[model samples]
Target: MTRLVVIGNGMVGARFVEDVLSADTAGRYDVTVIGSEGCEPYNRVLLSEVVAGKHDFSALTLPTPDSPRLTVLRGTHAVRLDREDRHVETADAARVRYDRLVLATGSDARVPGLTGLRNREGLTSGVHALRTIDDAREIVAATLNARRAVVLGAGVLGMEAACGLARRGVAVTVVHPAAALMERQLDEDASRVVESAMTGLGIDQRVGRGAVEALVAHGRLTGLLLDDGEVVPAELLVLATGTVPSTALAADAGLAVDRGVVVGDDLSSPTDHRVAALGDCAQPPEGGSGLVAQGWEQSRRLAARLCSPALSATFASGSAKAVPDRDPTSNVSDVVRLKAHGLDVVTMGVCGSQRTDDPAQRTLHLSDPDLGRHVEVVVSGGLLVGATCVGAGPVAAELVTTYTRRTPVPSDPAHLLISALTPQPRGATGSVADLPDDATVCRCNGVSKAAIVSCVHDGAATVDQVAAGTRATTGCGGCVDDVCALLAAVSTPAPGEPTDSPTTSRPREDDVTKGKHMIHSAETAGS
Candidate 1:
């Protein structure tokens, strides 16, 4: 049996293991998964929920360890990769041999270089960044004792972290170098709406200022010093500045490194075809695709190559194309990318590559400032090129799909966001009758409508239960609202029967701890 040694048991790595184990391949590989975290993989994207007190430790799990061929080593770090010897050394000096290697060493949040920030015990805490499940646990623990929190970035993470603390009744403030928040994913008009929504939730948004130094009184963080000579006081400081690829291990091994560990299209390291990298550490042809979807895809490609080497990849096989190139078939299989903030925002296929200034290019811009809503639909050459939405509704994903499929702009493109505004959208992606027999109702793992309906008929109540039964609405969660609707159609007892809540279908302890991607995608307004 071939042995596969996978490192960094985070989302992408854990996903690779699940895929390989579940696949009906020619031969099973002996899997050795090395995890730096003390526990099995959990959803890091939902760190905000942990901070918000919606879930303590109960709601975070990536996948399970059940395969007989799998040997999981938690709290062990891979100290070195020896390609010549076909072995890897854990930090404790245990060596494991492998026919193939997968590096899913996902990134860590970039802790900014701040001066004198400290914790309550009168010790310098420095900068705070959240990128792992353990990091979330620590931040949640710290927030309990913190009365005020200052986040030093207005990106999605900063906003989520800031808002989560605010939701828990902590005084929260966000500082951004840009004038607006989420500037990379949002435009001026849409950003205004998002800012309004956040401010309405009681988050202090600060811009055009940098923390010159952190104020530590005798060892604990008391406040931050501004470049403008202003002292802003807060009990805790979180630096959501950004992230860099976690590549120290790969770099030590002398693998090709750019923004990340440079790998070919098939995710094979340039130095050794026997070695492959997946997840945040491996920079695929797209060159360090920061999106989890891209990382998951790389894992899929590497798994296929390792388990079923004869099959050719759909995309360019050997020399990889840059991730920036728009491939119409990027959705050959379903992919779930989790970047959870309060907003249901999605960026796909070359964001901001739009002809905004051209009068000839058809564009529809709609905004209701009172509701903090803005939707921009730009159609050029009959392809839904780009869109931006920040508001009281769920239009970002709906618009992203239109742009992804190059869907024909309706006679009234304005209806794209409004058409699906049913109190609870059901069978609206396409008509139940017109949907091809293969169209997925639960797009997480490409479970078709027939599969879901069959499960509902087979005994599933409430959307959450159906999610466990069908694995639908468990990918990007864009479909959970629809799954809930399907549950409404499922046969149910008449009145007086207790309904499903967090009690009946709380998911098996194992499922909550490890089964599949529960974080899914960003929250659908209804989920």
Candidate 2:
């Protein structure tokens, strides 16, 4: 049997393995995945949801119950890639030989080039990056009592961070080089919506400003010095400088590099025939695609090529399936944010204001700051290219779907966004959220609703419990709210669940008292 070794078992690598097993494309592959993360494959797309208390971090999970042929080696990594020899060395110096290798070494937070961040104890604790699950947890725990936080970036991640900290009662001040939030995706009209939402959340937005350095005093972050000589004070500093492809090993191992690993349509590196890459580490066609779903698409197609004997390297673009829909659970965490205690802001597609100077795509936007509304849409040749929205009722999910799926723009033009902005009729059946169990939950983590349902039965009640129980909300935290909603669905009582039988007793532990009859054991399952 030919051996396929996958490195950096994060979202992308894990996705590749899953596609290999599930897809109908006929192939025979001996797969061995070496992941640095100790847990199962989970998402890293919505980490902000975790901070907002949307769901349990454990809900993000990818499984292989049906495929016993696959071997996933967790908490391990490909320390070195010998593309020529078709093998990789683990951090423990274990040499794993393979017929083919994969480089899914994802990116990490890019620390800014600055000064004065170092403290007297030479402590870098004050400097933080919101990249991994550990990173979000530390940021959350460290900012438990933080009075103020300085976020350096105007991108989607930065904006989300600003709102997330603010929701936790931390005074958040966003400092971005761009003049607006989500400048990459939304137009100026759409940016106004985000701006107003930020203001409502008590987030101080300072756009078109760059952080020159992180000022520190006595090993504590005092404030940040802007390029324009402005001093913004904060007790905590979050560096959302965005991520760069973590291709040091691949680059060091002599792989071709562009903005990321230059992979062909088949996800194999141009120079190394034995080596393949995906996710944040592998640059998809059209130069780059950071979305985890797209990476999974690549993984699916590649898995067919490697795992099945009927498929060969003569693959073409049309052979791959359409870009999968955004995970339904992606918004569940946010829904929890709205019903529960979280900042109610929504953004999709490109985050920042688009520039005429930039090439490709036309822009259309609507702004209503008085009502705290902003909507922006990007169009190219009558197709929804990109968009972003902020505020309570904007149709962000729809825009994201239409844009991502390359769905044709409606004839009315404004119908694409305006219809989304228009409130859905009560009892609306079709919605991005009106999904079934078979729907993928976390595109980043490859979790499903059925797996999450199993987790609910496993004693994971709260969102945090679910994250710990299933690893769902652990990654991007995007699906944190979705998982929470799912939990609510499972935990809440229906009209018929309770027997309504009279009882006489006192309060008991576990939220089920003697007289209350608060819960039904097996009866609730069907209910």
Candidate 3:
């Protein structure tokens, strides 16, 4: 049997193993996964929820069910790769042989260029980075004694850490170099709404400035010295600056390394056909968004390629094959959503301030600072190309679905938001039933309405069962309502069924289905 050795047991690596095992059920390959973390793969996306006291460590861990064909080596770090011998040297001095190697090495949190970050030993006290589950736990423990805490960076991780700490009654302040929060994703208008909403949540924000130094006095962190000569008092500092792709192993092995490990259209290393890369560590020739959904797509596609009969024959013949363009997840939604309570933010596609010269481009902006609501839309060719929604309530989900499905908009785009806040008029342009089956319901997993319907037909009668079977509403949990809507639309209830249960009957405006319950389940699934 061909041996497949996978480095890094992150979400991407674990998922690739799952896809491989599911496809190669005949046990054609002996698979071994080398994980740096000691525990089973857990969802890193929900790490903020863990710090918020919403989920325990074990709750976030993914399943690694026993299989005769698979072996998982937890807490094993690959230190060196010998491509000639097709073996990897682990930190523990053990060597793992492989016919094929997959580098899903993921990424590492980037710490700011600050002084006194460490002594002879690594990572001084009162300083932490929220990258791993262990890091979240450390931050959570620090919050217990931290009356005042400062999170450096106004990006997603920083905002998430700030919100999580504030939720636990810790006085939190976020310092970012960018003028607006999540500036890369949200426009200035949407950022202002989110900033105001977060301020009300007991989190202070300082923008357009960054920390100059991590101040350490007598073996303990006092606070951070800002670039503007202002010192922020804090007992704890959580650095959510950003992450850099972990590409050392690939680079050392003589593989092409750019911003990340360079891979072809097939997710295989350009210099080595026996090797492949995925997740944050990989930069595919067609490009990548560094999103989990994209990583999942790479994992799934790579698995299919490795298990294909053509691949087996080509491998035996030592023949070269052209990398076909079969990546479907690339078209997945670029929506950046926050799952925090009382903060509903979704930023997708282009929300930039600069107006495009293209006549086909249409931009709409709405901002109500008092109500803390912001909405921006960029339409090209009569379809939404970009959108940002802040505190738009359930209308945010509706807008996302409309955008994802490429449904025709009303003559007035503002009507989209209006219909969401209040009851729709007698005649509305779009409804859930009108959505195409091919339209992606779960953007993170690339799950379409037809897939959910097929799952329902395959004994996935309930929402949770559908999630388990098809991975709908799994990532980001933003599409839970969509999944529920599709479930109610497709599922047929038994005779004398309650109105609350799944039914073939179309969803009425007044009928309260199991949508909220399913959404809650989806939101808290990995929590």
Instruction: Identify the candidate with maximal TM-score.
Output: 3
TM of each candidate vs. truth = 0.82, 0.74, 0.87
Candidate 1 lands at a TM-score of 0.82
lDDT score, candidate 2, position 166: 77
RMSD of each: 6.1, 8.2, 5.2
Instruction: State each model's CA lDDT, in order.
Output: 0.64, 0.63, 0.76
How far in Å is the alpha carbon of 325 misplaced in model 1? Answer: 24
Question: In candidate 2, where is summed lDDT lowest over 10 consecutive residues?
Answer: 518-527
Model 2 spans with C-alpha error above 4 angstroms: 22-28, 64-71, 118-123, 309-317, 321-364, 377-386, 392-394, 397-527
- Model 3 over residues 1-527: C-alpha lDDT tens digits? 99999999998899889888987866799999999999989888878878877667875777675789898999879999999999999999999999999999999999766896776677778999999999998998888888999999877667777888888999988998887888877766677788899889988888888788888889888888888999898889988888999999999999999999999877888899999999899998767676787788777677767777666454334332311222132245366776665577776677644345677777777789899988877787767778778877566667666676567887777676667668666776444445666666666677666777778666565656777887765566556666666666566465777645533444443322544532232121111
Q: After TM-score superposition, what is the CA distance of residue 72 in candidate 3 from its true location, in Å?
A: 0.9
lDDT at residue 241 of model 2 (Cα atoms): 82
Where is model 3 more than 4 Å wrong at Cα? 309-330, 353-359, 410-422, 425-437, 453-458, 461-464, 481-527
Poorest 10 consecutive residues by lDDT, candidate 3: 518-527
**Native-structure RMSD, model 3:** 5.2
Q: Which scores greater on lDDT, model 2 or model 3? A: 3
Residues 1-527, model 1: lDDT tens digits: 98989898876788788777755255568899999888868766566667766556655665574878989999989999888899999989999999988888877667566667535443366345677666676777787788888898877677767877887788888888775576665666666777777777888777767777888775677888887887878878887888888888888888888878888876788898888888677777656535555565565556655555443343344422221122332242322222343444443332332234776566677777787777666666766666666553356655545654456877766676566443445644543324444444543344555666677666665556676666565444456545554444444434664556322232243433332323435421111
